[model samples]
Target: MMKVLLPVDGSEPSKNAILKGIEEGLLEGKEIHIITVVPGIVPVEGYILSPHVDDTNQQLAEETLTDAKALLADYPNVVAVTRKGDPGTEILHYASEIGADLIIMGHRGLGTFSKIFLGSVSSRVLNHSECSVYIVKS
Candidate 1:
């Protein structure tokens, strides 16, 4: 009855994490917590807003969660959710809130500059998360 957090960003690396877990027998029959964090709206008073981007972000988040949930359809104890904010922060917050014992995520995400210079969201979560983190390399 242990809890495991799976943060997916619709990336191959993220998908591999799930596959790795299953192959390693770590997530085969356990309850899983899946989350996809959409970048939150950053309003600029002087700039014009595109309604399309706002709606699209939320829609994308929902779709990502749906797809991720489907990946684990055989598991009955799965909880898929979506949040808005910094991906790393939200992932860790959700893990802490739910008291997840382990977190499985991708080594890198859609980030272009971050994963090159310092680290990606996965690295940030590893540094900040209170629980054990397993980062699946792409």
Candidate 2:
């Protein structure tokens, strides 16, 4: 069973990647791992974040994974997880730890216009990951 890693963020581009992968039959009978990473934003030294902030993020992450899974309902061997850290690094780590054979993700993430010149998470993973990477353009 080959392991596949897909990093999602609730963005339309990310959702497009997921749908595109399915259309390409890339996830058939594979052990698919769908993951979403939430930024570990800590309040400044003098500031404090409301408890609901973290709670809301977690809830949203869960919902995103659940919806993604539902989209691939025909596929049985699938798992969803949430992580906290730098998205690119965390995705690479998760793929390595799980022995992923391929990394399928969106070409664009939730970044600003600066991403057009700088590298996006997909670019970073493509450059850094040891495993094969497939970029789905939105």
Candidate 3:
């Protein structure tokens, strides 16, 4: 069975990616790992003074993952994962860690500056991933 990584961010484009993957039979007899990256309240190496910020980030991550789980529950092969870090790097790392054959994700995430900074998570994955990458747009 093939393994496909579907990274979502609770965005319409990400939802489109999930739907597209299912419609294309990309998940047929395969493992579908759904990921949501929560950029931490502070960078990994940075100091965070506000516990409130940390709590908020955690809550948001849980809510986002819960929604993602509900959306993907109909697919027998799907699994949900939530992490904190750089979205593109973490997504790509998880795909490699899982030995995924394909990485399917949205064209862009929740950030606006991503387009100018790195284009998108999809772009970064396409450039850095060793596996095949499929980016869906809404």
* Global lDDT of each candidate: 0.85, 0.86, 0.79
Candidate 2 residue spans exceeding 4 A from truth: 114-119
In lDDT terms, how accurate is model 3? 0.79
Better of 2 and 3 by TM-score: 2
Backbone clash pairs for candidate 3 read none
Error of 2 at 84 (Å): 1.2
Candidate 3 on 1-138: residue-level lDDT in tens? Answer: 789888878777777887888788787888888887877555556665677776777777778778777767777877778888988889888988999999887778777875453346778889999999887766
All predictions: root-mean-square deviation over Cα?
A: 1.9, 1.9, 2.9
How far residue 58's Cα lies from its native spot in candidate 2, in Å, is 0.6
Badly placed stretches (over 4 Å) of model 3 are: 43-49, 113-118
Q: Each model's number of backbone clashes?
A: 0, 0, 0
Write one digit per residue (lDDT tens) for candidate 2, span 43-116. Answer: 68987778888888888888889888988889989989899988898999999999999998887877877347
1 or 2, which is superior by lDDT? 2
